[model samples]
Target: MNKSARFRQSIDFIEEHLYEDIPLEQAAQAGYTSLMQLYRDFYTYTGHSVKEYIRKRRLSGALGLIKTSQLPLAEIAYSCGYSSQQALCKYVKSATRMTPLAYQKSETCYFFPRFDSETIRQVTVTSETIPRTIQLKFYYPKQRGIEHQAVAALRTLLPEYEGRIFGRDGEPREGLFCYELAVEYDPEVLNRLAGSLGQELTEVPEFCSTFAKTAVRSDESEIGLAWDYLYLKWLRTSMFVQDDGRYFEEYLCKGGEVKKLLLYLPVRKRMDYDKISVICCADSKFLVSSREGEQAEEEASAAVLKVLSRHHPELIRTAREWYVARNGMIYTCGVRLEQAIELPADSGAEVLLAAAGRYAVLESSSCSDREAFTALLDAWIQENGWSKEDLPAFTTYETGGQAEPDAITMRVWIRLKDVKNG
Candidate 1:
């Protein structure tokens, strides 16, 4: 097996024996690697020693049982590979600063999810340049129930059009988001068909910049997951940075069913250097939680938005979102506010100090990919010779930018250590 496969095998072995005594040598033997090499691999990839990984995994499993089941503490401890209930309590307190009983009553919990290698192989990203083409653009308001309208329009147009169709979810403009369906058609042919079609036909200029492209199923869930992995995981480690160009999808329809599409993201070579300003805030309020599962962050964000809409409607337009990730799992998500406001007792919000410090900020007109923006900001921090602080980072959406009227700018903030000087 290759390196990733070997590491995956070792991880599988460790996971299978998480509730049992897992020796470092046995885990290494499962992957046909030496114990020393296994230690290095775990640290390099997962940022945890093998022993630490096992311990955290055990704690995570035990905590799940603690919060959900009424099992006795001693039984829970033994089932999760703990020697006794006292040992489990000691580690839980050290990690979360809460006793098991107290933690069960708390609103938040820390969970370290398993590492899956299959995610790395799910989507393959390649670089390409798309030539200039003619496109039919469809504009729509940025509101609910617009997706069905767009899909209906595409269904009507796809049967008649014989060329390639591309879809783009454009940046917000005057409280509107454009959903353009482009087709490769001859100018003369489009001229005759433009009048019959209600939408505008525009000639897209040639794009010389390179783009990162990946193939994905056209289903909504798969597309969302692909984008999440791209922005949240891949971009942080990539050598290229996201460019200031629109991303789009090339649809592949068969038998009246759209099955797959090519997702394209504009990218450019990483600059040798870049600098950003730091914004400081005093305090903020948030509705926060550390949960598990693939949709945990999305669900938490939606809940925060719902509460804000009900209690603080005025702040909904410019609300900020934050997340906390440890050991490659994003375990926390919620809304953050810079302004101090008293929430009603039923608001379900908590106060979190927005510690005053220097931060690296990356502003983008497109708020669809906050994770990618944060990844770019992280790359900037590394390129500009700044160290990141152990603080929660966030992205704030500010409306009305200089670029356009009603334009929304997403500012990603990552706290930094003091600047190093020669």
Candidate 2:
């Protein structure tokens, strides 16, 4: 019944089934609370949440086994609840910036058990070398709407890759997974997988003409690395550098087991602005700084979100978390401050709602992108002539004086006005 007792019960559950499949719901049941509540309280009592604690505990034992045995990575990974060895490498890299074998190679492998009794035993440590994490150069088109038709178009033009894709690997990834579709001529592949399609139907709906995309996978570490290879090392050296523009991954839902997704630099194909709004967030701090070879700021955004969720779960329970690869972290942004006006009036009773109502907001990215885009949105608003609704709450930051760090904030507000009337 008490918080302390519930925690002890949950910890006991973890201890008894250390090797068992520990889902969050199951762990929460031990404390007789909902999964979200369990997560909040557990993380409240322990710096680590339930899943994190379990992962560390498992990784601890995994290190022990690695040092004590010569088992392969798959075995080590499966034994520790990782879906694949690649997934294991992903998690390790996210936390420690190394792979199982690389960590072993650097001789930084140590198994420190949380329970005191296990530390008494002396064990011999062994090490090994590991292959580097491979970078995948995935190509896609810019238009989400034109994706499927473009894929069908590519098949029509390139007769070799026509019906089936690459060595008959079945369908090239379908719509749900396809980020963008591209076409480019590959001299190497011209002799390889080139052919004609059903020929262009001029009378048919206009499909933006495309070059056959030369999407290839190779081992590299970062996107910048891919650019260096493609531009500096390979581009000028190769005879014809012309290719169709590519729409690489601009957004990610959950990057899953990826470190850096390889991308072809976006170049203009038809000499025009693609009618697409780059949906960016309030701050480009992490994403922009990454280009300067800087790590993302000590990310408290999510931590702050956690605190917000703890206090205002309802507003953020349905919150979206976007995986921005360049930044190398999940951005669990609360709703746009301007969206607050859409909420039911009763929502204001909650801490977040009240906070949202009072916050002075700014859409940092909306400001950063071509000013015309925001102007476009404002133009639409002006054209509609609907100005009575107040601007919504937005999460914004401020600086009172130069004496202290700038406030990393959560509440911001927006004001909607009729330009013609005002």
Candidate 3:
């Protein structure tokens, strides 16, 4: 069977035995894989370990029974695989900060539903980084036909200048709602435009740093459907929760007509992480050279580039390196390769394997403070109930078609600890 189908089979086994004791080995056997592989595949696919997934499903099932049936709490707990009513109560209270009786009396429910291959296939979600920008906001009161009024105002005002535009729905204040139309321009230019239009300009130093984005066509009559799908459907099933940042839409306008737009929903990790995604790297080879001491990274990179230029100059653009702290500092520089190649015996290079696995990734536009970036990622990993694997973490450098230092960016990838062992 295919990997996804086998993964679904394992999920089916979990659902079938949720109310019973399920041995980890048995669960792995259901998918025809070893326990370690099963753990890796489960976390990669569902963003949750098998044990955690089962615990959450049981909790959700118990909550459903409490709301609909008049069964005793002890019986409900027993059926949900909890040893005692007290144990179930403790779980509920820890997750929802409410006692079981209190939760039943109130209207609140904590539910983490089951996920299968079909559900994963249907849901489309992606992470995005929103750059810092300046904006001029226009607000409109909440009422029927306010959307039309906002659009008319935008059509009237857009002809004054040209730049990126965005729209957002704001919170209500004193029974009045707000619809903001944002234009990306310099503060000085936006100040002039605001003056001509008799509106005040608001300079936003930082936009939403991270967002969950989806594309939507402007031809859709009601954009509310997209929002509904994102919040009501996708949010409930995904490993992300809504963040405090404002949600907005980026308009792709042509001749004052919006042909399409991107809907950006501010989101943080449902768990302790910020914005986390999984990446699988293929097993590859790298031509590597290592150095140690102060300025080791720069010296190593320059040394590798010098070697590559003498031997294989065309591979410089594909350069990357790993930074490790040994006695003081150590940096290994190289170009990754998809296949093995013969090298000169005198060349100062060694072959290193970049092992294949699912890695948790974090990216930064600035590589100046790598320690700060790594510290943040390490805290996120531990807080989100994950451990770092005993693998070398690495950074990749990419150029933005410029030789300037500001044009280079870095991304960090660290392997996650195996769930079965963690």
lDDT against the true structure, per candidate, is 0.65, 0.38, 0.65
Tens-place lDDT per residue, model 3, 242-287, is 8897778887877767777778777765752222344566775777
1-422 per-residue lDDT for model 1 (tens digits)? 78879889999999998999888798999999999888767644553457767876788788777765799999999999999999999988877778999978764444555665333423333446565666665567654434336656766754566556677764456767767666665766566547654356677765566666667876777777777766655553343568897778887777766678777777665432222355555455555545567776676667666766877787776653553332245555565666676767665445556567666676555556655556656654554456888776676655563445477666677887876321
The predictions' CA RMSDs to the true structure, in order, are 16.4, 23.8, 20.5
lDDT of 3 at 21: 93
How high is each candidate's TM-score?
0.43, 0.26, 0.38
**Model 1 lDDT at residue 51:** 78
User: What would the TM-score be for candidate 1 when compared with the true structure?
Assistant: 0.43
Worst 10 residues of 1 by lDDT: 270-279
| Model 1 misplaced regions, further than 4 Å | 1-118, 121-127, 139-155, 158-160, 171-177, 272-422
Ranking by TM-score: 1, 3, 2
Best by TM-score: 1
| TM-score result, candidate 2 | 0.26
The list of candidate 3 runs beyond 4 A from truth reads 1-112, 116-127, 137-152, 155-162, 171-177, 219-221, 271-422
lDDT of 3: 0.65
